[model samples]
Target: MTTPTRRAAQAGSGALLHSLFRTKPVDRIVAEGGQGEGGELKRSMSLLQLTLFSVGATLGTGIFVVLGEAVPRAGPAVVLAFVLAAVTALFSALSYAELAGTIPVSGSSYSYAYATLGELVAWVCGWCLLLEYAVSVSAVAVGWGSYLNEFFDKAFHFTMPAAISDSPGENGGIVNLPAVVVVMIAMVLLLRGTSESAIANTIMVFLKIGVLLFFCAVAFTAFKAGDVTPFAPMGWAGISAAGSKVFFSYIGFDAASTAGEEAKNPRRDLPLAIVLSLAIVTAVYVLVGLAAVGAMHWRRFALSGSEASLARVLDESTGRSWPSMILSLGAVVAIASVVLTVMYGQTRILFAMSRDGLVPPVFQKVSPRRSVPVANTMIVAAFISVLAAMIPLGRLVDATSIGTLFAFALVSVGVMVLRRTRPELPRGFRTPFYPITPLLGVGFCVYLMVGLGGVTWLVFLLWALAGLAAYFLYGRRHSRLAAAPEGGGPPDSGKGAPAAGEGEP
Candidate 1:
């Protein structure tokens, strides 16, 4: 459908130039949904299952680990930061709902960009997504280590030593063994298959929610009006900065969109799951942030407050250890679930790319009995486990927010493009405020990216450069769209556009 261009015969500057601007026909992608020659994944997830997947992915480390770091930036006004970030997330969520409802395929934002934007931009989106999901998994895994250590100290009366628990250059440690172990555990579970993983995720979600509610009940008992005095002490600048940092918490909602092909009734359920998960997580973050701040003064919240900060707050407030001990268990469970969801997101994204011939076919190979991309999961798991075991948590999180923002911006743009290009296609969900919602989604995400600083920008540019090199060196010549015969596939598909995701915050 794309004029049947092949890199083998046109391996010249002409091919290179064509690679940059070459676009996939919307119709061809639409056909990929029904009776695709490329082999389809089984659709088994319902709306409830999809929602649990999203919530499980989103409600993990961010609220548990990020609050302590963010509160110091905005003081009591970190509550407002959560609110602002949720608003920012809603705009993108609406766009994702539109695209997911329209396409209902496995690529997420990468798929949407390919159908509406072009191949090169799609490659870049997928590349940025690699940073988002991989780093998120690593970062969350590291946080998991902290929580696991905390749980041992609280319930078992002992803790892992710094040498083996912390990452390189942190507290005199070289690598995080717990982090590596958690990541591998997730990999094993994933290898078992998607439905098995989904059920595990659902159980974890309920456990996490129950624990947060318990914490809230305990925290409000210590609430004092005096502590919240002088809210917004650092002013709007601080609130904005904190908002950018907390934005990571809202990224997991897109995980639902990544399961587009595997979701039963994807067109109807994907958008619902995306929106519902965002709403549920936003409420949880706001309530948790509010309760924690009310329980203790904001200045006490710092980087040292990481891992078991909420538990520490409860222990200090009630002069009891049992509350903190319980919270430690919750954090451990929550972080594990996040690792699982994030790793799942990365493998599925790679699987979609492989099926499109943008990457090696090994990633596209599905297990005969399990119906899962076992090889893809292993490759992603190995890379993330190394990153989790080696890198400091802070560094791992730096590129994730910026990468997610860039991907979200592109998806917002894609929504507008498709609205104009294929206006006749029925969308299951549409963004309210028309162009304004998407415009705000793009503008706000860019603003947050700017807030991340020059160092992050330089790192992202370097990463983007590496992705581009890989694309030109290998992916361009091997792309399925570039080699496929004309008049293949359907008009266009958007029921569940697999997406670019940063895992649970």
Candidate 2:
């Protein structure tokens, strides 16, 4: 693990300060556009929008789909796993908030890496983010399809064929049709532009939260405290395993940090978003987990996919089909929102990278009409839809955890590195415990990574190797920072040459 040199790390920091503080390409674009068009990019997001985005992203598939899997692993102690995962997420999120405030860019971890680590490492981090958000969204889409099938079966007495409901590995007939459909829908919404998606997400967020509240209300009626008597029947190992398994629920909290560029006041709102989102979501997760397990035995959970586990919990506790049907419908809506939000994050990161010349110019092309990256959104949707339709959600979820842990580890390390090297950088929020907090984040993330299967590690390794190869073969030669003339570009051509204007390719 070669860490970035202090000097190379400062390169991006300089760029950030210059881009944000001075009159540069970004300024030129804003000036060229009327006032409102440029203003939206920099205007601060409200506390409500920030909170909703975070909770909405974090609440999706993890609770609806992961609870069954985790319950089996940790027995009745799954609630503890939720608490521990929240702590780990809290540490990393604090670090993320600090960096987001300082860097204030759209690239999230990728931008931070570029500013501190250099071109090569930034490229790798961006690649890891691709695995984390894009693939995970698709995985969630597959889970959404399973729940949709169940919802339809109960509500309208209709069902998709098992083949269309499940992946090939799970004895399914064909493809995950609903998963594909949902991804396409999200794609269409994204292409329509950011405002439309935000409005849709806000509605989805309400629906998801309402359903969870309903489940909690109904579930408590069936709750029996005796079911949790042997809380740690599986012991510390089980608690750890469950925590690792369910950590994905907390993965999207960083979505708040990603919007630092667009934030009204990133330094103030970003930290609040990160902390508040985690606090709220963790409380909901713990309460829901406790209520469900308290209502029935943990042994009742069968680990097939999202639908099977949820169906089991519903029938065992309620002894009726209607509640399960409602839960299934909620899963469909929640997971679809999650996929949309997560995919949107992925595209924005790519947009930041392309704007910096880390990737191809095509990814940076914001539509003159809508201010959305039309080509980039379509390209990402097309790639992920195939995964959603064909790949098993279980495999994708496990892989996504690995990618997320890797990025968290990097951020933790970056926090320590930046503090020592550039103490002068203005951080709106500082991580609580300094070396201890970041180190804890790293240790916890690594422990979770170990709990994942060997196959996940192997796949992650392959992906990283492929990313490194691509960076050297393509990105390094064409990077904007590399092409720019020290002071910031208004340079020459498209490929390997500097960019001149705001929207020019």
Candidate 3:
């Protein structure tokens, strides 16, 4: 006995629910791989380039800067903390490797979620990635600027004035010029072509590894058995706290997955690159941590002037200023490499989302001559440069870690969901230990997210709410999936037709 008005309202609500929970089919997602608005992404990246891209994005300010903060919390047991954090990262890396192989798309977790968890969840994952990659790059650029100032003071005996070097409101500063400059440089390299950018990152990665080795050599020269006494001074609580702190060091190991469309053999090479890069970064961090504690007592890491702890250790070990200067030079290179690769990850994620019609089509518009998303790169670079240039980004930086952990947790769940939904699908890499590994990944991610405390949780909640608003206002109406026939795949699947304006300028 319902009236026409009531029946219409019920119908509208049903339609909204259907759109929210609709999942993209696996075959359809794969079929649309490189078919963006303009040119396709060139498949030019090899295993080595992909591996170094992750390494370059990951092995930055964490080891160079965060190590000092972590060592003070865990004492000589900081070495154990590094190992523990690596173990946590390993669990999630396994899930990422398996999914990256099975899907082989540029969206990373967002696409994986769309193929398993539904469109609403997929949009949330994509939003989290935006926060994780964009904010992390901006924060790292600010660190790079400080290190550049340190290098200049050490090597050239000249430092830029604080007003121009520091962010606004810090020491009477106006803008962080060096941070802006580094982001712009990374932007230009990205615009040229993906292959050229990969080559540049490879060189920078090797240079930073050599610099870390040089540090270990200098640190070991003054090693003493006395520094090993009283290990784990703060007990298990301290080691756990330090493990949570150092986990940020492992954030960018998934950078390789964002290059799925650009990789020559994504299914095989993506898994290898993700795992290999994590192993290399963990080994380097453990080696440096052991060497740092061996050369100087752990208590000194808590003292004043411990900002540049590794370089400080070098000065103490060699009783010379030259070694510290070399260390500062290495920090400059290490951070800039991170800026380049991470910014690259951010653009590719947007490109994938744009192709799904969840964002502006400009993000998917590639330059035919370069086979790269030129407008997307430029837009992302401009936004990040502004954030790095003007924002202080102090405690707000922790939001990046929370956002990343949330995405990682969703990926782990996606693995389990996909396994149940599509057991017959071929997988280039199977996560060994199956459900146990993915469950542990989810647990570890939650553990880290909780450690970030209440303030970070509040920030994440606000961000999620804003994302939902955007979805309702724009994403829902424009979604390509919604436009497709009911229970069918994407409308343009297998066609791979380029959108209008599809060639070189």
TM-score of 1: 0.90
What residue pairs are clashing in model 3? none
What digit string (tens of lDDT, one per residue) describes model 2 on residues 364-417?
Answer: 776666767788889999989888787776664677678888888878877887
lDDT of 1 by residue, 1-505 (tens): 4444555546676656665656676545544542222345567777898998999989987788788789989999999999988998999999999998877777788888887887888898999898889988888888888888878987889989999999999999988999999999999998887888998889999999999999999999999887788999999999988998788878889999888878877777888999999999989998998999899988888844665678778987899998988888898899899899888888777777877778898887877667788778899999998898887768546766788889899999999998898887667788899999999999988888887777788879988999999998988879887776531233345343332221111
The residue ranges of model 2 lying beyond 4 angstroms of the native Cα positions read 1-44, 162-172, 302-306, 391-397, 486-505
lDDT of 1 at 131: 88
Please give each candidate's TM-score.
Answer: 0.90, 0.85, 0.95
Backbone collisions counted per model:
21, 8, 0
Q: lDDT tens string, model 3, 1-505?
A: 5788898999999977878989988878877788787689888899999999999999998898766788889999999999999999998999999888888889998999998899999999999889888888999999888999898988899999988889999998899999999999999999999999999999999999999999999899899878967889889988998998898899999999999888888878889999999999999999999999999988888772545899889988988989999999899999999999999999999999999889989999989999999999999999999999999998888877888998899889999998998876667688889999999999999887777778889989999999999999998888988878884465524334322222111
- Scored by lDDT, the top model is 3
- Mark the regions of model 1 whose C-alpha exceeds 4 Å error after superposition: 1-18, 33-39, 172-174, 302-308, 393-396, 486-505
- Full-model lDDT for every candidate: 0.83, 0.74, 0.89
